[model samples]
Target: MIRFIDLGDQILEGQSEFAWWDTISDSFEEFSGNQTWPNWKCFEEDYLLDEVREMIQDMRPLDRYKSLFPRDWSGTFVSAEDRKKRYEKGICDDIIDEDT
Candidate 1:
């Protein structure tokens, strides 16, 4: 069950940002030959606010500060191919992590 919380005033407006690996490590881009790898998936040109909102629906308490790259991120690092996985499974690691 992929549950997402609202990213509205009750969610995003007051919450901090989240992030992922791709943004922090230079190796992925430097070695992989993909110079522009993103640490966060929120900036994907293919995604819009509505799409992001629809994709992440039942989550709440967005101020967890789960991940970080260049500043905070609106969402986690998700590949285009893994989009469905996130939608279906949600963010397992971050949600389970006690540190964040």
Candidate 2:
């Protein structure tokens, strides 16, 4: 089945190694059910937004998109904010799993 790494790769260029599988697998084990593949499409927009945010520092979102990735606007850029959100979400999810 499709996974986060693969989803990252397809949705965002050069993002295949964004996360660690061992952690994901271990987390999945605690879910107490089958681990279905992630929904890549749902994340594609966020990923693209983040990728654009990476190239240009201290710049507005629209400016970055227009200047850095105008031709290739797939919203693949992952921003620091997005990463932080993901990290927090993961931590929360992990905690819940641990408690269960």
| Per-residue C-alpha lDDT of model 2 across residues 1-100, encoded as one tens digit per residue | 1112333455344443222123423542111122222333433344345544454235333343233322433435554455566778784332223332
* Tens digit of per-residue lDDT, candidate 1, span 14-49: 343322223333222111222232333443322223
Judging by lDDT against the true structure, name the best candidate: 2
Which stretches of model 2 miss by more than 4 angstroms? 1-37, 56-100
Q: Write down the TM-score of every candidate.
A: 0.17, 0.18
Which regions in candidate 1 have their CA more than 4 angstroms from the true location? 1-70, 73-77, 92-100
RMSD of 1: 18.1
For all candidates, the clash counts are 8, 12
